[model samples]
Target chain A: MAKKILIKKASGEKEIFSIIKLKKSMMSSGVASGVAKRVISQIRPKIKPGTTTAQIHRLAFDLLKSEDKSYAARYNLKKAIMRLGPDGFPFEKYFAALLEEQGYETKTNVIVRGKCISHEVDVIAEKYEKNIHAIIEAKFHSHGGGKTGSKDALYTYARFLDIKEAWNIKKNKGAKPREATLQSWLVTNTKVTGEVKIYCGCVGIKAIGWDYASEGDNLQELIENRGLYPITVLISLNHQQVRDLLHHNIVLCKQLINQDTLLSRLGFHGRQIQQLYQEINKLFGS
Target chain B: MAKKILIKKASGEKEIFSIIKLKKSMMSSGVASGVAKRVISQIRPKIKPGTTTAQIHRLAFDLLKSEDKSYAARYNLKKAIMRLGPDGFPFEKYFAALLEEQGYETKTNVIVRGKCISHEVDVIAEKYEKNIHAIIEAKFHSHGGGKTGSKDALYTYARFLDIKEAWNIKKNKGAKPREATLQSWLVTNTKVTGEVKIYCGCVGIKAIGWDYASEGDNLQELIENRGLYPITVLISLNHQQVRDLLHHNIVLCKQLINQDTLLSRLGFHGRQIQQLYQEINKLFGS
Candidate 1:
């Protein structure tokens, strides 16, 4: 059986969990068995560059269902899946979901618009008790370039908004004054340039960039540093420490996805869970 | 015609470049554009949970060639192409080539065996007036379900190495006492966990961490940041300023990639480039 612990955030929401709980859930929910099958049946050793966003989605969804494990969506998907196009990248949404499962009460895909222009953002993410934390754009690019897109892209777009001018109207209308939005992003598998830098600075927007190759590290930093949120936890944490925990979890997930022990104990119909088992098995190459 | 520049490095190697210069060489050298074309042509959208490292390599090579650009190895294939496996992830090797094209001296398929074990790292990188570096490993996994692999994975593998113990031995004496070896990485479509914070502490080996993502506003901060260069760069310039320059360059690269006029001007003839163009077009599709 898994152990459970309740965590209270500064905002007063409490979440209960434990590795054991995750392990138990993996076993009882048939997530392990299904994942194993998904690994075996769905994962392929060769994929192409122009693959569609939806294809990637189906792969993930199929793998999840195969394992009899839910996507932990109630936490991240509530916002991620709703805000993003089928092909657009879903890091923040998914990470937020992971946090949610860990008991963080947050809202993803909250829309925030320029006060006057009404330019809509894809996601306005907020942690509970925090004020409008970040304006996020999840870009799913086919290539991973490890840089932002266009030096002049933001400035050109800002020319259309004049968000500062819009903010003035809101202030005059007796609304709370707004600071310029923090860092924005051009998360793609392409690179960015210097001109984009000049434009973003002029408009008070910062770009947190990512490419396909660097997505893993970039996403982790965005959440931990909150590219927009930069609050270090009162307790100290480092990237490696967090990476270890994640690796541990991923390994365990992989194991559960591969193991037969969990499936036998869970009393799941062996045939029904075969698909999930294949997916999990494919992931670890078993 | 593309502008020409000298490949300058902290180490005094001299090389001049021009579009015509490379064009003349490609034509006269009788390089098989077909190999590059075939490599890049194979790049297409990856099916989720089914993609493999080898597939990602095929896509990147294809993408590189289609830009009318050659893999860094095109002009120097004997030393470059001979070393790689047909179906292995070639990220480290590819980037090393790019760095070489930009004027940095490089090595390929170099090995560093573990002091007390039978493990070996794939590439060892070095440049003038700087510490040696290592391109450890490249991981490809299905996107989603939160985290994928990262630099921490490399660092975890580091503790298992007997660098000091191995170096002290007569056989491994050439390894040398150095500031640090670069912990360079190439991750394709993976996500890392935010909990991975391991700077300035003794986790496994002291100060052994991977610099997988960019951190700090300037290059100086980035290098000092420990999170960005676990593996590359050979510079004595101001870190922040270098970072700023990189920031600017990245933005510019993004712009260049997105500009239809520019892409057209570049005269790349590969199908992979076309795929990139199509993907971008789809992002802004009406």
Candidate 2:
């Protein structure tokens, strides 16, 4: 216990376990700061060198579950989002829904004209009174750990500028076009690198990643607090069935419940549908 | 021969043979239009259903070889370019050299600042007196049969937009900045599609691909006419040796010939270097 314990990270690097960092991460997951401190103290006695971060994560997850289901769910936010896709499309649709919830009207896969080229934007968001529109490039890496880096940030910022140029040109052409500011955003399920953070900051790009809690509600908070668990989060729905639901553009659990008929349409039997709904309700109340 | 012949395209799509299309393609390879028509008429009897476009290309190539080595080299231009990369970096350097030849100072893999982010541009070229600078995205597909499509076009355009925004900001900040204009270009060593053509034209992107002979010398003409055959075009060099040379940024055969020391530096023995030079001299005069 007196010795500093070295724990393995997901990226295979080893670092000393720090109570401050662990507590801050838990707090981001909606656990009270006091609760995180208490949980870490309890695990302090069992701590050993060479323990993987995953094992530490497992212990934290179990303790949070024992505390409350919602606490556990919030702590599990990243893993839940990771279940969203092996591709970025479903994540784009889901992110558009998130933007919609923020009172911004959103469109997915909108082809915007640019000065030097046209761009098939992943998602475009607008809130007229705010006079701000956003061009978001949603990057979702599935079922594992990979941080969104500077490349995504640069490209996302680039797309936003192109669209903004076209927007300004159109405005100049119109007799009385409404004023709107264009914003660039990079949304991702995974964490972001320091380079991404610095570059995004330098360029005025609003980047949101899973554990990005620098300001406002990050992607994790938005999903966890809103209970916007994707259909893939339902234990009853297998990967194929989840894929089918996503294919039908029904990503959220709430969306799935309303379209029980889609379950049948996607070739699921009655018992499977019932179980899915039952799990959905248990995970997220009807 | 009495009926119209069906030719299979590289993409596995079937189409009817058109003498006009074939002749135009040949003319783009530096064959005179009149000679193209004559060659087509000469091969008219050999036209039959189910012949691949590749077979037709072979016939034309053989005829060109018999006529002149330069014509054969022009005809083999696309195939030569295809060997330039299994990666794009070498092509970036080669394209930068091309820009240099056009009286523009050039750099490869430059990080340009942007309004919203910084971009690692593939190639950048400037002619200050001309008051214009170009940002080029050099796309090279390895060994054959892929294309520069809309996705690439959109992203390349996006990167340019971001860099241009940054460029303008820097220009405005300078006490006596040159009144240079920024332009975006996408240069590929493969064929382009109708979508790429239309979108580029619509958005003012200067899209140049392998067969893009609408106006000024296209990629084929630039390489063949200038005798800038890539080091990959040397049959004497195997893939590993070519890759090693590419790693050292010796892409053009001219670059290779000038740096015979580089061949030995890459661990090639005396005879291998001699044979490579022999092939280079035969393919493109030293």
Candidate 3:
């Protein structure tokens, strides 16, 4: 029998190491499949019997950084987005901006009356050309260990049903009837359970989570393809500094690179501002 | 072997029914040991092979109501307090009032600085006569099925440690220090896990919940002895009505009983107000 190598998780649980899982994660960061396999093989030999997952991640990240710095940053997407919150407002705003980049007009914190009650939607995306409207429930986990589960999916689906019923009622009442197709999409900054994925599939609701994707457009793809990295992704700033930036709605690193005065407005002074600029350039520079 | 009878739980899981558990629940409602045993014996035969715990609760509630209406209300105390919240603000206010009734000067939503951070305490009680100060973290679950777990207890203790450290620092700095003992209490409207109870006992942090008590003064004893029933206890009002009342800080039934205009201010119509008055009189009348 092959030796069972264990990888320690952040939560102190241990699981058997899987090279396949590692390769898939690398490929999701936009690395070519061939390079992903090569990188995995290179790191596999270095993995000891009881290697921590964090150490393995560091090894893979170093290789990816050497190969392509941007891809390395993209690989760290989950952790970066997590730093945007103790509250999920920043994540919602960033998600809206990502949708906006894809030619969708987006509104955050939109409240609409459902049949029995009012629903506060995290992000509402409208594609006028396609006449497509999506009420998005953005479930953000502030820490990496937390997974969005079936309970959240059930809650989101129920809300969608209510709003859909309300919409039909309004149409029948001849209150601003329009030819837009409405659908519900659950978006999260972390992975979701297999149960949630299956539930969404059965119900015709869309789910976009860290690793769970539909139509090849998961959160990782949406973020990396647009190069819209949150400001927390930068290694230069501390946790409090990142939180301060998020509080000011200065979400993306590209926003910081483009707007010089933004840092001063957020009360970043002297050496801190200079340090942040250097880190941004190093991470985002080709 | 005695026949195994299953009792369905709130979360839809079923377990073998234990008469001991049922008897304990009855005794916690202030029923005498002999009467509790009699009630248990009476209901034992009525319980079918696979009856739900909720059905058993209803049976006991009916029996208690017939025996003594106030005891019935006290039996429903946990559920009533849960109805006081979709948010915990109302419970905090009610808790503060309960402390006041015990001759303690109380404040809610008090923010005090810690060693490294600031903590927003749910309730702070100070008995000036005894020179005792207690910081309370009141965890209010909006549903009966929810539990206060070790995680919350741990978090509360950590916060208390931080504040205690800050307090020591202040005392050392000659910040007008008085010699008053500081202690932490974790109070909840739901039952806590055994792990939490054990942890609290070991650490000298007081844990008080619906059924979980320290030194015999559990949530049930406190509320019943003081006659501080939250307005949510009234069966006459719907969930939304209870929520609205809580939102306006009309927590206690006595508040509504005392002020006739309060119900009108809360937008309760003539018939609904009359119904509320009748229910209040039935529950709290001398």
| Docking class of predicted structure 1 | incorrect
Worst 10 residues of 3 chain B by lDDT: B150-159
What lDDT, from 0 to 1, does candidate 2 have? 0.76
Candidate 2 docking band: acceptable
DockQ, Cα level, model 3: 0.02
lDDT over C-alpha atoms for residue A271 of model 2: 88
| lDDT per model vs. reference | 0.36, 0.76, 0.78
Would you list the rank order by lDDT, best first? 3, 2, 1
TM-score of chain B of 1: 0.35
Candidate number achieving the greatest TM-score relative to the actual structure? 2
Interface RMSD of each: 20.0, 3.9, 16.4
Given candidate 2, what's the lDDT at residue A199? 72
Chain B, TM-score, each prediction? 0.35, 0.77, 0.81
* Residue A110, candidate 2: C-alpha displacement in angstroms: 4.0
Candidate 2, residues A170-235, lDDT tens digits: the string is 888883345667788888888899878877887788888887933577887788788787665565
**What are the per-residue Cα lDDT tens digits for candidate 3 across B43-90?**
999987679888898888888767765557767777778767678988
Best-matching candidate per DockQ: 2
Q: In model 3, which residue pairs have backbone atoms overlapping below 3 Å?
A: none
